[model samples]
Every structure is written in C-alpha cells, then in structure tokens.
Target chain A: MRPIRAKLTQLMIFGVLLSMLAGCSYLNPKPLKPWDRDVLARPEMQLDADSMEDLMDTKIYFSKEASRGGANIGGGGCGCN
Target chain B: MQLKQTGRLGPALAAATCTLLSGQGAQAAETEQVDVTSLQYREVDRVNVDEEVIALKRKGKDEKRFSLKLYHDTITGASPNGAYFPSDTYTSPSGSSYSSTLAPITDERYAVSADWEREDSRRQKTQYGLAYSIELDYDSLGANWSRSRDSQNRMRTYSYGYGFNYDVIHAEGGNPVGLAPATDTTRSNQDNKLLFDFLGGVSQVLNRQGVFQLNYGLSLSNGYLSDPYKFISIDNDAVVDNLLYEKRPDTRLGHSLYARVIYNIDDNVLKGSYRYYIDDWGILSHTLDMRYRYKLNNDFYLQPHFRHYSQRAADFYSIVFYDAPAASTYEYASADYRLGNLDSLTLGLQAGTRIGKRTDLSLRYEILRQTDRLGEFPSLNASILQLSFRYTAK
Candidate 1:
C-alpha cells in the first residue's frame, strides 16, 4: 500500500510538471492545417464521440464500481447497485 | 410519462423538420439533432436493466441551443440480502430466499431533463440544466451549470461546472430501529440526502495528432446516507440467524483526479485514461482504461477496450459483526460489497458503421471479472451487450 501510494504521488507530481511544460509550449505557434483538421472535423474525433453511449457507460460503471469520475456531472441515485 | 414524452417528440421533430425545410431555399442551416439509444445490462445470477433514452437538441440562430432528454429503465433480478453464504436456508422479508435460492425483484425508473446552452462568444460557452428522476422508493431533483473557454489558438481549453442533487429516500418498511442488538423500529417518514459537486478541467492539444485532458472534481454529500434495506449478519457463529440493520455517517466528502489522452496514427486511434479517487471514509481507488479504434474504411470502424480497476475497503466496512451489543455494532458500518476491497477488469469490442447518409449503427460486447477481498464468494462474472443507432434528419 505504501509503495502504491508513493507511486501515485510521483505520477501526480509528474503530471503536474508535464502540464507546466505544456503551458510554456503555448508560446510557439503551430496551428493545424485544413487537411489536418479534416479528421478533427469527423464526429468520431470529438472528445465525446457519442454522448448517449458515454452516458450509458457511465451509469453502468457507477452501478458496479465504487468510484466514478472523468465525466461531466452526476445525476440520480438508485439502490440497484 | 413515457407516452407523453414520446408523443411530444413527434411534434417537436416535425416542427424542426418543417423549419429546416422552410429555410432550405435560403441556406441549409441544421437546426436540430436527435439521438435515441437503448441498453441492456445483465449480471450473472443477478440484476438486469433495460434502458431507453431519447434526446433532442435544437440549435437556434443566435448561438443558443435547447436540449431535452427522456430516459426509462426496467430493472429485474435478485440482489444479495447482505447475509453470509447459506448453509441451511435463509429467507428475506419479501419471502424470497436471501441466499442461493434466488428470488427476483422487479422495479422501474423514469427520468427527464432539459438544458440550455449559449455560446457567449467564439471562445466561450455556458450551459444550465435541470433534471428529475423517480423510482418506487427514491426521487431525485437536480440542477447544474457549466462554462467553458477555448484559447485563441484552440490549443488549450478550460472548463468548470457545478451541480446539486436533492434526493428523497423512502424505505419500503420505514427506517430500521437499532444498529446493534437490532431492535424493530416503527415506520418513519421520508429521509433526504443532498449532494454538491464541483469540477474543473483543462484540455490541451499536445500536438497535431494527440490531445489530452485533466480534471479535478469534488463531491460533498450529507443527510441519510445509509441503505435502508441492507442488513448485516450479527452472529455467524450461532445456528440461529440474526440480521442487524446497517448504519453509516451522515456526511461524506470525496475527491478524484483524472487524465485522458487520445492519439491518432494512420488509421488507428488510441484512447487511454487513469483516475485516482479518495474519500473521507478511507476508501481509495485507481482505474486505468484503454481503447484502440481501427478504421476499416471511410464508413466503418472497430474498437477494442480494456479497463482495470482496484479499490480498498471503507474504514468501517465489515462482513460479519460477531457478538455485538444488542443495540448496534459501531457508529458507522456497512456490509455492502461495494464498500469492500475488490478488483475488476473489463474487456470489450465494439463495431460500428454508417448505414447510409443519415443513419449509423453500432454494437458492443464486454465481459467483466471482479474478485473480492475475503474470497469467500465466487468471483462475479458479468457480461454486457449494447446495440445503438443514430439518425440525422437531413
């Protein structure tokens, strides 16, 4: 348990450091080209490719698991779990 | 409620279609999008849920959109009665077997929600929403608001949201009396619970083919947080059976941080995410999920997903409270497996393709395996299958 906690702490710190580096990278400008944006324009490229599917998956996970996160908002509660 | 919502959708769709067609001569402005989905969820020798959801969104000319959703669920199955493994025979209050005999329970749920969004400017958007859900013994009403902003170059984005949920919980036979040396209590009035959630995040495009997002979220809940129907076995050593009602703290605070990355290479897209969650109740969890989507062609794709999750038990979780005071075992305690230590893994595959210009179809199948701490119970095996269709009225 201690090792896992230590690893997670290190990972979190690394993630924060990486985020800082990325923030500095913003100074340089390299906009995506129209051709590059073609794939981005596709529905599949969107963060939530299928909103309804994502929502249903969230519900399933919530019911089965003890943890929930990385989604928009929480709605309803049930004893079904 | 289902019939009314279904009826309303027909007129709403017709009106939107009429509006779009009427303006076709001017410019083809897409004004509406509709999504309908159905899901079937099943667990081995356990519960099953069939759900249907319909969502409608209308985009106005002034950078504003209105969205509505109708959801219905039918649940049927036998759930654990919180007792230990059966040696002879045990029965529940509903006259069903509390152990391996398996008596089924049936219930239904309905939910409705509406939201409004306005793009305040080219780089900013704001949304507000309200929702309500109802079941036989529970009712919930909630509201939420969110805002997002994009950087000038579109390389970075930030978002924040807050939501509140008010729930009224009614035990079928009223609240249980004592926690230890369990005693019978009279039926009590409805109890309530409140939840508040706050979340903020940043989405960054690491490069042309890669993007990632990180988010921090907090949830605070208060009020009657115990499950009314759950019971804890007090004396496993004795042949005579004794079940004590469960009790939990009135307030809980939870925090979680998550990161996700999506990268595209050639004809494949890889998605990965990790989430770490902790709560005041001494439960900690880590989840890792990964997926790879392969494009078969312009109109078709296949994706394979894998997820691994592990969690520690809550501070007060216990399986059997032996020889406790007749009144209660402790201040906060539960036998619910969900609060106990466990690990689970999921493997799944999804195939989808465009049926035509306006319709698309997708199918998915997954298998999950979960193992608990005590190893007294068999590893739970669950399988899920989903079929979905999306249609656009052009």
Candidate 2:
C-alpha cells in the first residue's frame, strides 16, 4: 500500500471533486420513514451486534494479536500469547 | 441463529405494507412533552450499564429545556486466555506451545456515569458527563469526563478521561513460574499506570437520513500492557510443553478513525459504519458493521446485523512464544490467536404492545455467532433476551 499520506490525499481530492462535479443526481437524500428505520433503530442492531458475541470475539482477538482497541479502554491479567 | 435470522425475513416482508399505509415525509411533533428513556443492563461481573435519560420541553417550544442521564454497570465474566489443541493438531501461523485447554476466568468490574444536557430553540445544544469504573481482582479504577455541542449544519464533541490501575502479580509477587532471570519483570508485573484519553469529532447532517462524522482520539498510558496469563511458546519441543510466562511492553500510543451512514426507508432502514485502528506495535485493524431494520408495523420490528474484522498480530506476538523467544523464553505463550480474524452475524426479533394508552412494553431476543479467520480455530455463539416496559403520562 502507498503511504498513509497518499491515501488521505486521495480521499480529500475525491471528496472535493465529487462536490464540484455533480450533474443531475438520482441519489438525493430522502425523508425518513418508519419502515426504513424498522431495522436500523433496533437496539439489537447497534454497532457491536451482541455484547456476548463481542465479548467472545474480543477475547479471541486479544489473545491472537498485538492490536487491541475498540469497545473498551483497558486490558487485564493474561498469560496467553 | 441462522434459522431465526431467516424467520425474521417473514415479518420484514409483512412490514412492507406500512410504507403504503403511512404518509410520506417527516411527521410534525407536538409541543411540550417530557420524554424519558432508560435501560439497566447487567452481565454478572463482566459488563453492566444502567443508562436512564429524560428530556423535557415546554408546552410549545422548539427548544429542549433539559436532559439527564445516569448510568451504572458491573461487568463479570470468564475470559479465555488461550486455547491449544495438541502441537501437531494445532498449526496456527503464530504458534502456541502448550497443547492444553484451560477453563475461563471471571473478572469483576463496576462502572458509573451521569450526564446533563440542554439546547435552546436556537438549535444550539450543550452536554456534560462524568463516569467512573473499577475492576476488582486486578484492582483498577477509571474516571472520565466529557462535553459536547450540536446544531444544524455543524456538530462538535470533545472528551477526556483519567485512570489509575494496579496489578498484584506484577509488583509484589515473585515470578509466578520462577524459572530464570527476570529482565522483563518491569513491564509485565505489578503496575501503576495513569491513563489519559482525548477525543474530538465533527459531524454534518447531509440531509435527513444521511449523517457523516469524523473523530480522532489519542491515548497515553504508563505501567504494564501485558496479559499476566498470556504466555509465549518457543520451538524447542522440550520446553514447548512447559511454556514460560512474560509481560508485554508497558506503554504504547493508539490512534483511530470512525465513520457511519444511515439510509432512510419507508419501512426498512439500512445502516453501515466502519472504523480504522493502528497502534505503535505495527498492528492495523479495520472493522465494518452493517444493520438492516425492518418494521413490521407500529408494534413490531425485526433486525439483522453483520460484521467483519481483521488485524495483524503484535510485534512480540507468537503461537508458541516464550517471552523474548529470541533472547530467553522467559514467558510461556503461543501466539496462536494473538492476531486472529473475526466474523459474526446477529438476528433479532422485537415485538411490542401497549397495556393501556400510556404504558407500552416490548420483548426482544437476539442470537449471535462468531468464527475465527483461521479455519481451524474454534467458534462461539450466544443468545440474549431483553424485556422493556415504558409508561408515559403526557
């Protein structure tokens, strides 16, 4: 992959160009509807999906790698790799 | 979960009728209503959050006079350190030494939070909050404070936190598995670290259903960052079975970015979010979360969610690692999953009915299943049930 700066620059340029070059658009923002929010508004549909699932996944992920940061802000006693 | 997840489709399709029956466009709101919503969650000793919020407005005004929320939670659960199937049987890239299976552990935790917010009709809003948490056994307490503002075209939020932590195994105790010289007792053993965190974000409402937010967070921590139970394994077959235990680097820096989007629908809403994370240890991660909510009617709904996560192992990661495997296997651990892949799915059902004109209750159930990227790794699944009752005397 290119450097981080390159990726950021590309995104900025894309956003600027997209804003300046919009012709007739069919994807305009629409009004909010109850039916549409039916799925998105549910608590079960929150970012983590299920806490139990996230907990299990977090344990698995933490044990398997050096990277750890997402839901919470701490680590605990562990002898595993 | 898959079957129930599939069953949810039936209601979603049935809810399609709502779009045709209801009028289009946002509905008008009534003036002067006091609305309060709250949830108290408990997870034994693993995780718990009690969040109660109340919003009050005058009889006929565009401004929200006041809002308050109080949260308290206690978390307790058995977290697995690492799992190993026999040496030949387990072939993870990182490698694990002990061909063993250990029972899970229950770590205790408690947390509390309170917040107040206000917004004048001018559309400007301000919010302030305070939070605290303590993890028993390991003996750690976390304190935090936050503030934010919001309006029409632009929104901004800023927050800061401080924490003090201590580990008994690190400072006072001798090497639990006394075997050799301890050059690395400093980072892994007993610890006192102060934590500082800061977050700043900007948000823009691109229309009704579309919103974009960007955030940057910096965290500085001292003390130990290693897992007392997490050990590394070395390849010397003899000592491999009896892995050594070691600590990880004490301090590190972390930075990340987050973005989310929601699309409005007549009866079905679509939402997606992504987060990118990186730290000093050369580990990078990306997470994508998507959910679709389907409304069956005014009293019913079904939702499905999917998630994908990936990350590389830490620099000192390994399956069969002996702390400082290269120098002297001081710690015992197999980096078997130190850097594993994760994929999950969730399906839920929500049904609500009113006991009277002013009291409403809802029942919800969700099933989640997770699998590791390494085809050989184990898979775990869970089921949860939620019951909520609300009473309003407007």
Number of the top lDDT candidate: 1
Question: lDDT at B363 for candidate 1?
Answer: 82
TM-score of each: 0.85, 0.61
Taking the tens digit of each residue's C-alpha lDDT, what string does model 2 give over B108-152?
Answer: 333333333445334445544444434443444444443445433
Candidate 1 backbone collisions, by pair:
B179-B328, B180-B326, B180-B327, B180-B328, B181-B326, B181-B327
iRMSD values, candidates in order = 2.8, 7.4
List, residue by residue over B146-174, the lDDT tens digit for candidate 1: 99998887777889999998998876767
Tens digits of lDDT, candidate 2, A1-81: 336744664475356335423411322344444455444445433443333334333544453344444344332322222
RMSD of each: 5.3, 11.3
* Model 1 alpha-carbon drift over 4 Å, by segment: A1-29, A33-35, A77-81, B1-31, B85-103, B177-183, B236-241, B324-329
- The positional error of residue A26 in candidate 2, measured at the CA in angstroms, is 17
Question: Residue B91 deviation, candidate 1, in Å?
Answer: 21
